[model samples]
Target chain A: MLQIKDLKATIEGKEILKGISLEVKEGEIHAIMGPNGSGKSTLAAVLAGREFAKITHGSVKYMGKDLLEMSPEERSKEGIFLGFQYPIEIPGVSMVNFMKTAINEHRKHRGEDPISASDFLKIMREKKALVEIDSALTSRSVNEGFSGGEKKRNEIFQMAMLEPKLSILDETDSGLDIDALRVVANGVNKLKRDDSATIVITHYQRLLDYIVPDVVHVLFDGKIVKTAGKELAIELEEKGYDWIKKEVDSE
Target chain B: MENDQDKIISDATSGEYKYGFYTDIEIETIPKGLSEDVVRLISSKKNEPEWMLEYRLKAFRKWQKMKMPEWAHLKIPEINYQDIIFYAAPKQKPHLESLDEVDPELIETFNKLGIPLNEQKIFTGVAVDAVMDSVSVKTTFKETLADRGIIFCSFSEAVQEHPDLIKKYMGKVVPSTDNYFAALNSAVFSDGSFCYIPKGVRCPMELSTYFRINAANTGQFERTLIIADEESYVSYLEGCTAPQRDENQLHAAIVEIIAEKRAEVKYSTVQNWYPGDKNGVGGIYNFVTKRGICKGEYSKISWTQVETGSAITWKYPSCILKGDNSVGEFYSVAVTNNYQQADTGSKMIHIGKNTKSTIISKGISAGKSQNSYRGLVKVHKNASHARNFSQCDSLLLGDRCGAHTFPYIEVNNQTGIVEHEATTSKIGEDQIFYCNQRGISTENAIGLIVNGYAKEVFNKLPMEFAVEAQKLLEISLEGSVG
Candidate 1:
């Protein structure tokens, strides 16, 4: 469970997220549809506790705790996963070791014992199969020399490994091909449970086709301008964002 | 613009004195001055031969006559020899049966450095020569190294026991008249490791030297000489740490290496002197001369260094290729953090035809540090078909750090081929965000990027030293990277 009250975020003192309020319960998939510069990614960054952007006035409560007070790592430990649009290329850190450290940090934060190396490898293999990722990528440095599709799929692969309670997919579907998109969608769809939730942020309705959402919201000028069922995403794709903007202007 | 000014102001601050440690131990230090008498006293203390004493006096006179060179691209104050006590040796009475005979203070020093002499000597079973201040106190695994016909001893002992070897090759590659600091080190230099790999013999295991400067108001002028004879091979490693001090202490050292026909010499150094604090009021002023000569045909010399300390570093470890088909290589990774300044590089001289040399340098500057890579490639008129390749890259962790590259290329022969490349990069916030989104924290992300930037140089270090170097790099850039 999470609550966002009048969330307004700014980067370089320019307002990006303007007075947005929302609530998400357990086991729900929320699709955010918007055009470019719609503050979709800013919303994810604000939730994950990026320090650069300032939260001028907002209260974000996650599981009855203040999310703004935590660090980026602490937010991660609290089960907030933000799948990056562009993955970083860490040249010498092997993907397996990186994933292992993350899993252990999260586990340690939760007061659980560290996972055994054998168990880590076993989990890696199992989840890696869920995302249909090639095992060779795990041996190289994290995202170093990785293709665009492989990078997106690697994000999903990491999501499956961490098993977060709430996952934020910020434009994960931007660079993925159809097959890779299917693989990523299947991975997210498979990892869902009764206690977990997903917020799929996207510009098109194509991603919503794979991972259908319970609610679709349209974001414009740093504010959510419209809310509808899954057909809203389909309607925005058919009629374009200008129609939505005109409707908001009329309101 | 604000970022640039922050970097400029921070660089103006100077380096740290992280390695200043004091222990209650008796030390036989000379009077705080430099003269012919001081050199004579140092030689007499070792009971050296007449020729050796004469050599020191000659070096002292030359040093007195020569002024310190100001041509280096470093901001350093004038060093007053009168203010520096040139000699300091631990008075625990040097004797070597095992690590147990080592001083407890020295053992504590090594432990703080993360290289426990007792554990390393017992587990990995490599001999350790512990050099505190300016003298070598104990040497481990002597019998094994000696069994292989490899002569390992202190320079003082070498002067006494094997005068022939010392007289034959002393200062041959880099003579006492070579430069200002080399001459200074030659005058009042205390003691350091001396190794000679005999013909056709492979050294049994790694030979290590851990140098520490414990005394305040004292300069460490240590000398190390290693010679690998024909058909022989040697791999030498050196590491240094100093106690924290506010006033910058002077460290001027000379390291000479000679590789004969069909021989290979590998020398690696991890210099982690106490870098100064963020304000950069005090640290070590490292002025060193390290050079090697490939005398016989097909000889090889390689230098690998991980320099992560010192307020100011000025050194050039070079090689003179004299034999046809000889090979020379230099791999270096120099990192300066929190007001540190380093000006270092290498030189490769091609004299023999068809000789080849390779230089790879990686510099990481964080928290307003200024690190420069200055190198030279000179080919003689007779060195037809000689070749050289140089690559220098730098990674700036913050907007306040600076990295620079200065390369000199001289060619006299029309048939030589030389290639040079350089690049500078910054670790931007976007890069960090990419890693954070994938669940990797910022610190781990920094470590990964830095390690990746240093992989080329890390490959040159020995496997064990490579691990330690990586760990040191990650720890050194602790607050800056994150």
Candidate 2:
């Protein structure tokens, strides 16, 4: 469902993601673990079509289409959703209206009629319960004056609303308490399906316990130095990234 | 006619305006130039009554003796009145009897502006009277509005059909000699709307007038007067847009409102005229005089405006609190982008005991534009216990933009309490990045931040206009952020 070949990304003329190649089939969960500034979030931003990132040379194909050729909004409508590490606050723009617009914009891009307001509300209520997202958060402007936990949960809540095929969670658990992390991980676990895939980007191994990934990759510098099973996250947690760096250096 | 400051100011509005499109529409325009004979010709064309002609003559004489105001914080070249035409209407356009008689190009302009007048039911609770150039293309909801003892029609017809009402309130708030442009507007005003709400009636909808300037080198002089009688309430809205012109055009307008005892009047304006190109060579110079008077005890008047257009805007819609316990309020959100310059705010005069006034203004400057907020609040000795609260906030989108606030507060009453506060801030990169990290696009983020900053003023506009204004705020600052 996704293919990135030699993904070389730079921001402000400085190279960040250097020669990254990855492929994930449908129904698989892939986790990328790295220390701070290991280009973990940069990968997510590049995949989400952020304009500030410079794609010096690379080919990213989503569903066999040239992803780099599309705009951020176009990529979003094409079922590519990135759960922002820090959600935006849009004061005066209620969450309901924002979701409704996103939903309808995606629907319009598919040449479909807008969902009725009543029907839209029904899905929103149902998804709100599934994600454990507070009703108050849903009523307020998108993430305006929200807590860190609420912002992360709101991203998951929107993921449920849009139902994107490829969901990239960027540091969803960075600032979450254990309880909040459980709720966020639970939401992601519930959304996983046989036809959809999830790419979890995180620094800690704790979040991996809740949303167990089928594959774990270590991102050192700009490239993934090693790909392992779920046990690899535990190994790194016990030994720390410095131990792995020495082992990779010797190898 | 050129200097460093003038060049800097003119550089703000240099570029083609979004609405400046050339359409192949037939028009009936008079020759260029201004004179007493032209004023007489306009009055004769309207077939005005003898008294109105006399009034026009009086205003023309006042205009002749008055000198142009140069004190405003603007950089506009001298206007050669003789080089501009005074009157123009569409060819084959008689008194509009039906919507079909309206010019298709004018309707197209409104359609592009997202203000289609044919809609029967929509937000903003009312009908719209679309005035393109010098004529009203169509006035909607006439039957419904007329049923409520309301008189809504062109100023020309009002002079003929409701002369008694026109005579009673015309120039009652802003007299012909109030300012230089006002005298000019009164002298050769072509056409505008006049509305009257009788005693104890509340207007059921939001009344709107859209002015579209299409003809070249023809100044737009319009006169609008609305009166709410005793125990009545009414809200009136006006907006305008013009085609691009390399030669600067003049728009001098006068608006007066009167509220009787226990009556309320709310006036809102969303002025978006063609503000000359990025270099400010040919945009409209909006010199308007608008004032309202609360004549009876407990009367109230409120003015709200979103001025985002015009090359050099010089307007100060004001209020006179003459009635005991009367209230006055002014809320404004003015924006200057590119070569635009606006020195606008309002003045409030308190003369009656216990009169209260409130002023809230937000100014936003983007690109190389300059925006200023000039306001005055005065309380007379007789206005015991008079209270006023003023808050002004200015937002600078880019570092090159300029924002200035000039407030004059005068109090002669020992019991009056007055307070003023102002702030200036930039759309900091941190705030934007914080929003972007949450997946919201930069454009939507700017809109959200601006709406939050201008919420106090946006709340002053009617609900529908507020929504439209919010979207317009987003559209106006599209490239300003990125």
Candidate 3:
């Protein structure tokens, strides 16, 4: 469902992603293991259509269409969700209002009538239950005073609400506690469909324990240097990025 | 991202003024000049009493000797008094017995403004006094109000019908000599609404005056007076709109209100006069003086305004708490887009013991506009146990715009308690992108953030006025971001 070839990206004249290539099919999950400054989040941001990351060379195809051609909002309407590492805090915009505006815009794009208020409330309740998030969060301003873990869970709740075909989770498991992590993982697993795909970008193998990956890739210095099965994540977690750096530099 | 955000904000300022259409009705206009003779002629044209004519003549002489005040943070262009037409009214019968006798074109104009003169067609439960240019076209629900001893009519009618009340309270709150604009308005003011609720009575419906400036090369000077007697309560609304013009049209108005013992008065304004073109070539110079007084113990007065138009808006609706234990409140949301500039706020003067007041002002500036909040809170020596709280917040949408606050507080009594808070915030890039990533457009994102910022002040407006104010905010900032 997605393809990337020789993706070289830069920000502020600094190369962050160099000659990267990857592919993922439907019904599959890919775990990208990378150390700090290894361009994992950069890739996610580029795929999510962030404008600051200039693609010096490469093309990304999603659902057989040029993904780079669409704006961020258009990409969202096209069923691509990016779980931000740091969810933005928008004061005075309640979660209900934000979600309703977003859902109506998506409906408008799909040639459907806007959702009724009662239907929207019902859907919001269902999504909140599915994500195992507090109902109180939806009544407050969007992420204004939410804790780090709550913000991440709110992002997942939003992912559940939108029901995107492709979701790129960028460090969503970083600040979560064990119980919160379990709930987040269960939310992702529960929302999984045979026609959809997920890309989990994380540092360790802990998250992969819950959401098993179909394939594992090790990235170093803006390039993925190794690929294997789930065992690769365990090996990396045991030895860390030192071995990956040694192998890549020796090449 | 910064460049894209700038493009979006600049795009927002290109929204066309929606109420900038001129009617094609025949109009009668006087010569362009300010003189004793001109003032006398206006009073004579209205068939005013001798005393009313003398009032106008006295104001004219005062205006000639008073120079325009330049204390505001505004770059006002010099206005030549002799270059403006003081009076312009639609040519029609002097008096109308029903909506059928009104000119069809005039009716169409009011209808276009969503203010129906025919009472049967209105569902908003508002008693309207529709004023076009220099005269009141019609006032609805007059007899219903009269049944409860409520006096609701045009200012000219009040002078002729209820002269005692007019003589007692016309300039008690805001005198003609209060300011440069007030003097000019008092000298040549053509027409506005006058409302009075008798002692112990409650006004059945909202009293409103919709002012439309339809004639070319003319200034609209309307004087509104409202009085609530002992134990009475009334809510009055005022709305203004003007046709588009290449040269600036002046809109100088005066509003005075009084609340007697245990009485209450709620005054609201939604001023959407035509702001100039994108280049700031032309628009209304809105200089207005509005004030109120709590005249008896336990009385209350509240002023709520949503000002979204006019090229230059210099207004401060204030209140004087004269009775012991009286209350005063002011809530305002002023928006400046394109080349508009607004300097507005409120003033609270505590003169009696145990008085209280609260002020909330929100200003939003977009494009290359300038918005300022200037307010004052004063507790007199005799105002023991006086309490006051004031909050002013400013939001800026673009780097080119500006937001400023100037708050003054003075307390003479040691027992007085006052608190003031002020803040300035920008429409952050991250906030906009967060909404955009959620499938909303940049324009809608700006609208959401702006409305959220002004929600506090908007909550004080009545239900219908609040809805219109929100829509006006959206339309004023539409397509700012692409």
Candidate 4:
């Protein structure tokens, strides 16, 4: 469903993702795990078409189209969703209104009329139930004063609303307790379709226990050095990132 | 990606003014210049009484003696008052008994403005008084209003028909000697709306006036007076627009309201005068003084304004809470783009015990425009337990724009409680990207964020005005983001 060919990305003048290449097929869950500053987030940002990450070289193809050529909005409309590592807090913008606008934009892109207010409310209620998010949280400003776990759950709620073909979950498990992490993982698991794919980016293996991955890739020093099964996450968690750093530096 | 975002911001800030079309109808304009004779001529032309003529002469003399104050945070150029035409009116039949007697071209002009003057077709439940240049062309639902002892008509007609009411309420809140613009407006003020809700009567419909500057080089000075007697209630709104011109036209106007015991008055304005071109070569210089006074106990007055036009705007709609336990509110959303400058806010003067006031102002500045919020909250010595709450927020769309806040609070009564909060933020790239990642375009994202930011003030506006206010905000800064 997605292909990355020698994806070289940079910020300012420093290279982040150095010639990374990967491929994922339909209905498969891929886990990209790395320590801090290993270019995992940069890879996710590049896929999402974030502007600050300059594509110094290489190319990304999503659904057989040049992903880098599309705008962030167009990419989203074309079924690409990026669950931000740190969700932005937009004061005064209610979550309901924000979701309504987003849902309408996607509908408009598909040449459909905007969802009726009643239908929107129904969908919102169902999604909230699926994600176990309280109605109070959705009624307030978007992510404004939200707890860390609440923010992560809200991201999942948004993902459910958009129903994107490919979703890059950037540190979705970060700052989440066991219960909140279960809710988020359960949401992702429930929303998975046969034609959709998920990329879970994380630094720890705790989240992997809930949302199992088909393949695990350990990113180190701006390159993917290790590719293996889900056991690699447990191995990395037990052995720690220092061992991987030592191995990569020696290689 | 940064370049893309910047391009979107630039395009949004370059939004064109849609209401800049000039009507090609025959207009009769007095020669340009200002003098006592000109004021007298305006009065005689309106066929005012002797007392009214003396009032204009007095105001004209006061205006001549007063110099334009320069305390605002504005770069106002020296105005050549003598070079501006004091009066301009569309040529038409001197007396009109019905809509059929009105000129067709004039009716067409109002229709094009989305303001259908025909009462039967006005489905918005609003009674409109359309003012073109120096005279009122039509005032609908006058008979329906008159049946309920509610007097709604033109200012000139009120002066002629209900001179006693006009004499009692005119300039009672904002006196002619109030300021430079007030004196000038009192002197050469043309046609505007006059509404009086009798004691214990509630106006059945929304009273509105649409003012348009159709003639070149004409300074539109309109006077609006509204009086809600004891136990009465009324909601009044005014809208203004002008044709595009290369030379700046002046719009100095006054609005005064009086609320008696148990009376409630709500005044709203959607000021959309021409805001000049992208280069700021021409537009209107809107200097207006609007104020309301709570005269008796338990009276309430509120002001809601959406100012989105004019090259330079200097306005402060205020309320004087003089009655015990009276309430006052000022909600405003002022937007400026592409070299437009706006210095607007409100003033709340608490003179009675247990009085309360609230002020919420949202300023959005795009392109090279400058927007400032200057407000004052004063509690007199005897106004013990007077309370005031104010919030001022500014949103900037581009790097070239500016936002400023000047809040002054004075309390002589130790029991007065006053609180103020302010915040200024730029439309961050992250906010835009967050919206874009949700499939919303940059333009729509900015619109959503801006509308959300100004929702507090918009909530106070009447339903239809609130919708129009949102649309106006979208058009004013349609293309730009920071």
Better of 2 and 4 by TM-score: 4
Question: What does candidate 2's lDDT look like per residue over B36-96, in tens digits?
Answer: 8888888887889988988888988998999999877777688899998889877656676
* Shift of residue B331 alpha carbon in model 1, Å: 1.5
TM-score of chain B of each: 0.94, 0.94, 0.99, 0.99
Candidate 4 structure quality by residue, lDDT tens digits, B1-482: 56775687778977777788888998888889999989989998999999999888889899899999898988888889899999899888888998998889899999988899899899999999999999999999999999999999999999999999999889889988999999999999988989999999989999999999999989999999999999999999899999889999999999999999999999999999999888889999999999999989999999999999999999999999999999999999999998899999999999999999999999999888999999999999999999999999999887888999999999999999999999999888899988989998989999999999999988888899899989988998889885
Write one digit per residue (lDDT tens) for candidate 1, span B1-482: 24533443343233323445666677888889877888888888777788888888888889889988887777788888889988888777555576677778777766776556664446664567878887887777766788888898888878888889999998898899899889888877888889999999988788888888888889998889999999899889999988777888999999999999989999999998877667787788999999999988999999999999888999889999999999999999999887789999999999998999999999988887799999999999999999999999898876767898889999999999999988888776666666665556666777777887898889888888899888888778765653
For candidate 2, the chain B TM-score comes to 0.94
Per-residue alpha-carbon lDDT of model 3 for B242-271, expressed as tens digits? 888999999999999999999999999999
Residue runs of model 1 more than 4 Å from their true location after superposition: B1-19, B94-121
Instruction: Mark the 10 consecutive residues where model 1 chain A has the least summed lDDT.
Output: A84-93
- Give the CA lDDT, 0 to 100, for residue A197 in model 2: 96
Provide per-model DockQ scores. Answer: 0.42, 0.13, 0.77, 0.82
- Ranking of all candidate structures by their DockQ, best first: 4, 3, 1, 2
* Interface RMSD, model 4, angstroms: 1.0
Q: For residue B14, what is the lDDT in candidate 1? A: 36
| lDDT, each prediction | 0.85, 0.84, 0.91, 0.93
**Better model by lDDT: candidate 1 vs candidate 4:** 4
Model 2 chain B weakest lDDT span, ten residues long: B1-10
